[model samples]
Each structure stands twice: as structure tokens, then as C-alpha cells.
Target chain A: MAPALFHLFALLTVASAVGVVATKNAVTAAMSFLLCLVGVAGLFVQLDAYLLAFLLLLVYAGAVVALFLFIIMLLDTQGQKNWGFKKFPIFVSLIALGLLLTGLGTFVTRGQLDAPNPNAAGGVGAALKPYAYQLFTTYLLPVQVMGFLLLIAMLGVIVLSKKIDGVEDVK
Target chain B: MIDFWSNLHPVVQGLIKGLAVIMVIFPLAGACSLAERKVSAWMQGRPGPNRAIVPWIAWIPFVGTFLQRLGVFHLMADGAKFLFKEEPVPGHVNKVYFALAPAIAMMPALTTITVVPFGAYFNAAGDAIPLVLANVDVGLLAVFAVSSLGVYSLILAGWASNSKYPFLGSVRASAQLISYELSMTLSVIPVFLWINAPGAPGTMSLAKVVEFQSLPGFWGGTWFVFLMPLSAFIFLVSLFAETNRQPFDMPESEADLVGGFHTEYGAFKWSLFFVAEYSHMLVGSGVFTLLFFGGWNPLPWISLADLVGWLHHATHAAWTIHPLFVGVLSLGIFLGKVLTLIFIFMWVRWTVPRFRYDQVMKLGWQKLLPLAIANLILYALAIAFIQKSAS
Candidate 1:
């Protein structure tokens, strides 16, 4: 049952990812992206990481995708159907794709990660307490840096979006 | 038969349970529509939907009239009409999404019900354990995650309608639902913090929160409403907005937007949207009751265990401790509170005027969000202090 579910989710994720690129309509692409996120969240659930699964759905599928759809609809971007990718970018993406497949080939054929001890103190997929403790302790600096990065991005968006009536008001 | 049932896969068992619950909830949502009509009529000093009746069934005298007056027949009529009515697909509208919107509306509403524990039974050791469909650790968060997807249906409906009013209504809906979600999420943090103390299992389960309220003591036995009325208030307000009940019915503001996000919908599809809306209300009310009113408990201080004890004391019968009896009674109490809350929802609908779109936005972001944040900070400090000092 677990293997079947994993295959189902993996298939769904891959198919939806393809759809996101293949679909011409902006709204359709956004919805496909949402489906891809849900499929990934399903895989997370299968790993006993229920918190991560729900957080993924709640933050990305719930809010972020909805906002993406909102903007796509508001902008009515379908008129740019003729705006296909240029040859140079396509050539670059082909090289990137080859590099990705080569990386995957190396990992599957030769790469071996250090087998984690099952009795470790805490890890990413542990139950809430150990998981939370790891974040605030072991990964504290990285977490704080991520928080600061998000804060900076938020400030940037506000500054860029907010219109000012008078320019050069500051001394 | 019992062996076979026990041998069934957990997923199969869950599917059976989910189907059973959805069957019950679907009709109850239908009944709610009838209740709304009757309540609105009563408020206006007029009869509502009393004229619809079966020919032979109406011959039964006082009971028939009572049923007719209560509009029980109208539910059946409404169901039949929606089923048989013409399902129109407009020419200009987006075909796929227009067809998918109502089904999308229903998925999350019904899915949320499985996460909520509706009743309880006292085990032999005498702990009142909740009977739920899927008793997951992230109970409330699962509900929030799924129900948040409900906005998609409205957005899809409005966008697919390919019209001015629906487009506006859907936009307003997505904005309102998203805005209120922040406060709603923040407001419940305090409740969880109180329930999950220093050494506790750190669960966000709704049943465990109820269990915390059931514990014997001044602080323990008191419902969260009496303990944290501000969280309850913020949660209730957010619930109203999330469920799109009046006066927060910005999505459908029929007066201005001509049925809001569902403007182009009709027939069974339209009925599906309203049913999903009522289901959301039912689930929201149940969550509120669980969080604030001591879910399945008879009163604030009186736990279900206490009630069962009192019953056993009164009757001195062996049947009082029976799981079936306790389950039914607890279910009755939970449903009783839910019905009362639904009535208040309808009551407020009749009493208050629809909020303007701008006002809804302003209230959700400016007023409720700040209030909820302050309430959280206060509760966090107070709970931290109490737990620390006690240790």
C-alpha cells in the first residue's frame, strides 16, 4: 500500500510539473503548480512528516498559489501567448537539464549517503518536540538567517509596491 | 463478520467511516437550509415553506401540521427541485472550471468533518475518549489546510463565470478568507499553549484540548471561553468570516454583487455551494464548541465523566456505564451546542446588515489581526509564568 501510494504521488508530481510547463494558459499553469505542491506534500506525509506536509499545503497551496492565481487573473496575461521562450534560453535550459540528469545518474549509480543512526537525538522528520528543538538548537543560525532573508524580502516588496506622492522627502 | 471487519484495511475502515459521516452531514446541511427559512420567517412574523406536503402524510393531524410548520417537507422539495432543475452551462464561461467549482467547494468541507471528533465513550478504566474518524496529531491544522482550499472553488467560480459581478465577488472572497485566516490561526495558538504545558506531549489535537478542559480543577475544568474569552471572540469572528456567513458574506453580497462568487451557478451546482457553506458552518461551530464550550461536556465545570457519574448515581443501573449510552449522550450534547451556534449564525444573519467589502477587509486586517496578536502575547506570558512558577 505504501509503495503504491508513493508511486501514485510521484507520478502525480511529475505529471503536474510537466503540465505547469506544457499548459499555455497562465491560470492553468498556476493550478498545475498547485497540484504539484499537493503531490509533494503527499510524499512528505508518507515519510511520517505530517507537520511538514500540512505546513507545505497551508503556506504554499493555500496562500501562495491562490495569490499567484489572483495576479494571473488580474493581469489577464493570456494576450502574451506569442511571448514564447527565445532560442538562447532554450539552449541554456537544455544544458541545465543535461547537468540535472547527469547529477541524478551519479546519485543513483554511485553516490552513497552516510546511513543515519535510527537512534539519533533529533532529525528533520521527528515528532514535533525533537523537530522543533533541532530547529532552535542545532539549526538555529541557519533558521535565523532564513528569517532575516524573509524579512528583507518582505521590506523590499513593500518598498517597491507602495506608491509615494512626494519623492525625495527624506533629508 | 466481526473478524472480517477487523481484518479490513485501515484505509478501507476509514473510507467506510467517512462515507457514513458524510451521509449524515449532507442531510443535516439540507435541514439547515430549511431551518434558515423557518427561522427567517419566524423573525419576520410569517409562515415559511409550510405549504409543501405529501398528500397522504398530511392526513395525520397535529403531527403533520407540526412537521409542515417546521418545513420538513420543504427539504425534500428543495432536494428534488435542485436535482431535476436545468443545469445551464453558459456559452462564454470557462467550461472545465465552471463545472469543477461546486465539486471543489464540497471536497474540503466534507474532508474537515473527519478530523473533528463529534462524540466520546468512557473506556473501562473510565477515561472519556473521543470517537473521531481520523485522530491525527495535527487535527486543527489539517482542517485549516483543507478548508483554506475552499477559497479556490469561489475563485474558480468567479473567474470562470466570465462576468463583472462574479469576478468582483470571487476576488473579495479570496481576499477576505485569506485575511481572516491569519487572525484565526493566531487566536488558537494561546489555546494550544495552555493545553500543551511544559512537559505535555505537545499535541495540537482538538480532543486533547477538550481533555484539558475536562481535567478536575478551577483552571482545568473551566472551558476556554471562560478562561480565554478574547481568543474565543477572535476565533468566532474569524469563523464567521471564513464560513462566509453574514455580515461577512462579501463573496455573495447579494444586494450589491447579485449572489457574489456563485452568481453564474444554478441548479444542483448552486445547491452544492450552499451545502458546502453550511458544512463549513457546522464544522466551524463544532470546532468553536470544542475549543470554548467544553465539547461533548454538558457544561463548563461539569465534565462528561461527571455527568456519567451523576447518571449512574441517579439510576444505579448497569446500563448507565454502557458505551452506547454515553456515546449517544455525548453526541447529543455536542450536536446541541452546534445547533445552538448555527441558530446564532442565522440569528445574526437576520439581525446584522451585510458589511461593505472595504469594511470587511479593514476589520479582518486592521482590527482583528492586531487584537488577536495582543491576546496571544498576553496568554503566552501568563501561561509561561504560571507553568514556570508552579514547576
Candidate 2:
């Protein structure tokens, strides 16, 4: 049952990820991107990382992807031209292809190919407790720094989006 | 029969429960629509939906007249109208998304109900069986996570319609849902924080929450609502907004947005959005009742433990009461509470005028969010102080 769910969601994630890049319309791309996120979330659930699964759905599927759609809609991309295959640069493509192959080779050689089922150790609540404890205790400073970084980014967004009285003519 | 039933696969059990839930919820959603009309009519001093009745039933005497006057058959009429109505997709609309939106909208509302514990019954082996569909450990989180996907449906419908009204409606819906979602999530933290056993991870399970409320010991087994009234209030208001109910229903304010994100949708598809909305309301009310009210308990600090003494003596069975008897009584209690909450929803819909879009946003972000955060902090401090004193 677990293996079947894993394969199904994995296939869906890959297909939708490809669809995200392959689609012409921005809205269609965004929708496919959402499907990819959902598939990933499903995979997380299959692995018994229920916290990560829910968070992925809640944060990404619920908010971030919706934001992407909102922005796409606001921009009115109905008339935007689709990118053509001919416009791609061969050298950049070759670099990306080489990087992917190297990463896969390294993963196959070094990664633990048969890690034991993580959920076997404890229930869902127990699984999340230690990760949460580590985040708040050992990694507290890094977490705070990340939060501060997000705050600054939010401030930047507010500043950029703010309407200045004399800015329309100046721009 | 009982042994055979108990031995069935969990997947098959889930499928059966899920189907049963659909049968119940779909009809309840229809009934809510009927109630909305009746309630609105009463509030406005007018006769409401008293006409639609089956001809055969209507031909009977006083009982038939009473039934007709109550408009018991109106839901059937409404369902038929929706089914037979013309479904015209506008030419310029995005065909794929337009078709997909209603199904997406309805899915989460249906799925979220799985984790909501209507009742719990003790089996013959003295095991407590929760009357929930999917008894996941992260039950409440599962509800939130699944229901959040509902916003996508509204956004898709709005954008796919490719019309100005729907576009605006969807945008408002996204912003509104996102804004309230933060406060909604935060407000529930305090409930779980207080419910948590010392040094143990806080439970997100609905059944656990109910168990805490029903137990005899530990803070006198008080309902979370009375303990954290402010949290309940915050949660309740957030729920109203989250379900896009009255005053906060700016997204689909007919006067302003002409049915909002579903402006272009008609007939069956349109009804699906309403089903989704009402289902959200139903589930939200149920969640509130579970979190705040003493779910499945006639009163707080009153579990089946108290009844066990009497039940064992009466039946000469094991300490556990019969699942069927307990199940029916608890289901009745749970549904009674839910219906009361639904009535309040309808009452509020009639009593409160719609909030202006800006006011809705302000209340969600400025008012509710800050209040919820403060509530969480206050509860945390109180819990810490109590723990320190106890030690």
C-alpha cells in the first residue's frame, strides 16, 4: 500500500513539475505548479511526515501558489507570447544537463538507498517533537535570523508597493 | 456479525464512512439553504418557501398541510431546479478551470469532515471507538490543511470566468481567506496548549480534545470555551470569516460583486459552491463545538466513566456500555449542538449587515490577529505559572 501510494504521488509530482515548465499560459503553469506541490505533499504523507505534509499543503498549496495565481491574474498575461524551444542557449542547457547528471551520480553513489521507515520509531506527534525541540533550542539563533530576514523582505515589499504622492509622474 | 464487521479492512471501513458522511452532509447543506430562506423570511416579516410539496403528500389532511407549510419538500425542488437548469459556459472563459473549480471547491469541505469526532463509544473489550471517519493523529491540522485548498477553487473560478466581477471577487476571497487563516490557526494554539499534558507534545486530535473536556479530574474537566472564552470568540469570528458567512462575506456580496467569484456559474455548478460554503459552515460549527463545547458529553466532567457503574449493573456485561446505545445518544448530543450553532449562524446572517470590504480586512488583520496572539501569550503565561506553582 505504501509503495503504491509513493509511486503514484511521485509520478504525479514529476508529471506536474514538467507541466509547470511546459505550459504556455501563466495561469496554467501556476495550476500545474500547485498540482506538483500537492503531489509532493502526498509523498510526504506517504512517508509519515504528516506535519510536513500538512504544512506543505497549508503554506504552499493554500497561500504561496494562490499568491502566484493572483500575481499572474493581476498582470493580464492572456496576450503574452509563449517561449519557444529555438530561443534556448545550448551552452546553458549543457551546463544544466551536466549538473543534473553529476548530482544524480553523487546521490546514487553516496546516499543511503534503503533508510529504515522513520515512522517505525514513533507516532506522528513524537516524530515532530524532537524536530521542533531542535529548531527552538539548538537552532534558535538561525531560526531567529531567518525570521528577521523575512521581516526585512516584508518591509521591502511594503516600501516598493507604497504609493507616493509625486511618484507616478517621476517614474 | 459484530466479529465479522470488526474484521473488515480499514480502507473499506473508511469508504463506507465517507459515503455515509456525504449522504448526511449533502442533505444537511440543502436543509441549511432551506433554513436560510425560512429564517430570513421570519426576520423580514414575510412568508417563506411554504409552497413546494409533493402532490401526493399535499393531498393528505392536516399533517400534509403542516408539512407543506413547513416547506419540507423545497430541498427536492431546489435540487431538481439546479440539475435541470441550463449550464452555459461563456465563450471567453478558460474552459478547463471553469469546469474544474466547483469540484475543487467541494472536495475540501467534504474531506475535512473525516477527522471531526461526532462521538465516541466503548466496545465490549472496553476500548473507546471514536465516531470519526479518518482518525489521523494530526486531526485538526488535517482539517485545516484540506480546507485551505478550498480557496484555490474560488480563485480559479474567479480567474477562469475572465470577467471583471468574478476577478475582483476571487481576489477579495484570496485576501480574506489568507488574512483570517493566520488568526484562525493562532487562536486554536491556546486551546491545545492548555489541553496538553505536562512535558508532552500538544495534541491536535479532535477526540483527544473531547476526552480532555469530558474527563472528571484535571482543572475539573472544564470545556475550553469557558476556560478560554477569548480564544473561542476569536476562533468563532475567524470561523465566520473563514466560511465566508455574513458581514465578512464581502467576496460574494451580491449587491457589490453580483455573486462574486461565481458570477458566471449557474445551475449545478453554482449550487456546488453553495454546498461547499454551507459544508464549511457545518464543519466549522462542529469543530467549534468540539473544541469549546463538551463534545458528545451531556455535560463537562461527565464521561461514559460515570455511566459505566450503572451500565455494567443493568446489563451484567463488561465495564463498557453497548456501542450502539452509546453511539446513538452521543450522536444525538453532538448533532443537537451542531444544529444550535447552525441556527446561530442563520440568525447572525439575518441580524448583521454586511461589513464593508475595508472593515472586513481591518477586523481580520488588525483586530482578530492581535487579539488571537495576545490570547495565546496570555494562556501560555498562565499555564507556565500554574505549572511552577504545582511543582
DockQ scores of all models, one per candidate: 0.60, 0.60
Off by over 4 Å in 1: A111-117, A121-126, A168-171
Docking class of 2: medium
lDDT of 2 by residue, A14-110 (tens): 9999999787888889999999999999988877778889888999998899889889889988886854555366678888999999989988898
Assess each prediction's global lDDT (C-alpha) against the native: 0.91, 0.87
TM-score of chain B of each: 0.98, 0.94
Give the 10-residue window scoring lowest on summed lDDT in candidate 2 chain B.
Answer: B301-310
Q: Please give the distance, in angstroms, between residue A42's alpha carbon in candidate 2 and its true position after superposition.
A: 1.2
Best by lDDT: 1
List pairs with backbone clashes in candidate 2. Answer: none
